[model samples]
Target: MPVASLNDIKAKVGADLGASPWIEVTQAHIDTFADVTGDRQFIHVDPDMAKQTPFGGTIAHGFLTLSLLSQMGAGVMMVPDTTKMVVNYGFDRVRFIAPVRSGKRVRGHFTLAAFEEKRPGQWQALHNVTVEIEGEDKPALTADWIGLIYV
Candidate 1:
């Protein structure tokens, strides 16, 4: 975990938070995400059916890849010692730029885009997050993700 104070974060608002370790996007992972989200699209759940599609095989759900940000962010950042709680504020924008085919590896790279104090001991942060597919030129997705840190 990378620890930084409110002043430190504000000072480096546009700094790279760094990338997370690569993780495989398996068919099972996609299937479970689909089950949980009730988003059983053939391209995500049925390999045989998806093989005939443009992707040529099953791919991960965009939201599934996006959801990994929480886990990935953990590897890239730590809650500041002064903060007692943190919560997802919401996303300002999100775009799925590429498909993450099942069994492919993916990782997240983040930049701190914005930081502001909403009130005493409460701060708002926006991060520019990109999910990269291994060996691919284009990223799988990009988002302006926001979080609320309470101190």
Candidate 2:
């Protein structure tokens, strides 16, 4: 995580934080997510059947890609050292704009959208997050994510 002071965080509002390292979305990962979420959609798990679809082959679940933001954002955006805890408040909006086929690489690009002290020692932040599929013009997804930091 990018450790910073409260004031430092405030200073970075509306700034582009950075991009996370690329992460491969393999078929194994997709299958495991399907098992855990019980979303056994043919497009996500049935490789042979999925080949007939326009996606050509199995594609990762949209939620699976959305869930990756946490892992992708851990170091890309962060709270100050004084913060006792942090929480994923939720997202204002989320759009799955493109498909991420199995075996593809993706990364997250983040921008600090909003930051305010809701109350003393409690801060709320909004992040504009985009998941880019490697070598693809269109991003896999975009979200207005929110986080709460406790100091």
Candidate 3:
């Protein structure tokens, strides 16, 4: 709900283990990303070529999918106070355990993994983000996202 205290944060921790703003990985999205990142790997940019590969089709880049975590998990968290600011802290034990193929819809599940006080007005939170790929047995991605909230 609002900015939670170090202790009050427990209630919000491990909360919202879900997804929102569902998105589908399309050839177009992948192509644009390839243009931006100069990563026009056949597996990610060419559907025909990728189809012959192990994954069977072009897949979204792991980083591109990971980049959507916050967007997909939107409304799942907030700092209640207007004065509070949230800054990305970093990641923990991040791993791309699976592939997100094109044409697949994906969403994120936000689970508060841990929290700690940084200072009198700041706190750090670690969230376990599980991104699932629709119709896939394995999740597209899993990462521990950290953020610093200033109250």
Query: Highest TM-score, which number?
Result: 2
Which lDDT tens digits does candidate 1 get at residues 69-145?
Answer: 98889878645668888899889999999999999999999998888889988888889999999999999999999
Query: 87-107, model 2: which lDDT tens digit per residue?
Result: 999999999999999999999
Task: List the candidates' TM-scores in order.
Answer: 0.95, 0.98, 0.88
User: Which one is best on lDDT?
Assistant: 2
The Cα RMSD of model 2 versus the native structure comes to: 0.6
Which whole-number lDDT from 0 to 100 does residue 149 have in model 3? 79
Candidate 3's displacement at residue 6, Å, is: 6.9
Writing each residue's lDDT as its tens digit, candidate 3 over 82-104 gives 33678887897688989988888
Find the 10 residues in a row with the least total lDDT in model 2.
74-83
The Cα error of candidate 1 at residue 129, in Å, is 0.6
**What lDDT does each candidate get?**
0.89, 0.96, 0.78
In model 3, where is the ten-residue run with the lowest total lDDT?
Answer: 75-84
